[model samples]
Target: MESDMTAALIRPVAIKLDEVTKARVKRLAEARHRTSHWLMREAITQYVDREEKREAFRQDTLRAWDEYRSTGLHVRADEADAWLAELEQGKDIEPPPCHK
Candidate 1:
C-alpha cells in the first residue's frame, strides 16, 4: 500500500469504468507521461491513504470527546491560541494546562 513501492511484488487487478471515464483516464495518463494502469493504482493508493488518516482523526476526536465528558477538564480557546502563537514565534513551550 505504500505509494513508492512500485518495484515490490505486485498483482493484477481489474476495474470496470464507463467509456467516458475510461477515455478521461487514458488522456490524463498520456498527458502525465504514465500508463493508465499506473494512474489508477496511484489514485487508489492515495484514496486509501487519505481515508485511513481521516478515520484515525475521527477516532481520536471521539476518544477526546468521551474523555472530556468524563472529566470536564479542558483548556480555554484563548489559552490554546496563546500557546500556539508562542510556538509559531519559534518559542518551544508546553501546552496550557487543561482545567475545569
Candidate 2:
C-alpha cells in the first residue's frame, strides 16, 4: 500500500521554461542545496496551497455577502472593533451578537 502511494506521488511532469528562467531556477536550486526538480516541485506545491487558500477565502466572502443580503443581520463595525480591542487587552469575552 505504501509502495503504491509512493508510486502515485512520484510521477514525472514536464514543463517548459525559457533558457534564462531555467538557468535562474538551477542557480537558486543549487544555492538552496536542492535539486532543480525538488525546487520546482516545492514551488508548485506552495503555489497550489496558496491559491487554494485564496479560493477558499473568496468563497467564504461570497457566502458571507449572500447571508448578509438575505438576513440584513450583522454586527456594527464599532461594536466589532470594541470586541477586538477587549480581546487584544487579554480579555476572553464572547463576540458581539449580530443584529438586524
Best by lDDT: 2
* Model 2, TM vs. native: 0.91
Tens-digit lDDT track of model 1 for 27-86: 999999999999999999999999999999999999999999999999999999999999
Candidate 2 per-residue C-alpha lDDT over 23-60 given as tens digits, one digit per residue, 9 for 90 to 100: 99999999999999999999999999999999999999
Instruction: Report clash pairs, candidate 1.
Output: none
Output the lDDT of residue 3, model 2. Answer: 95
The local lDDT score (0 to 100) that residue 58 gets in candidate 2 is 100
Q: Model 2 RMSD to the real structure?
A: 1.4
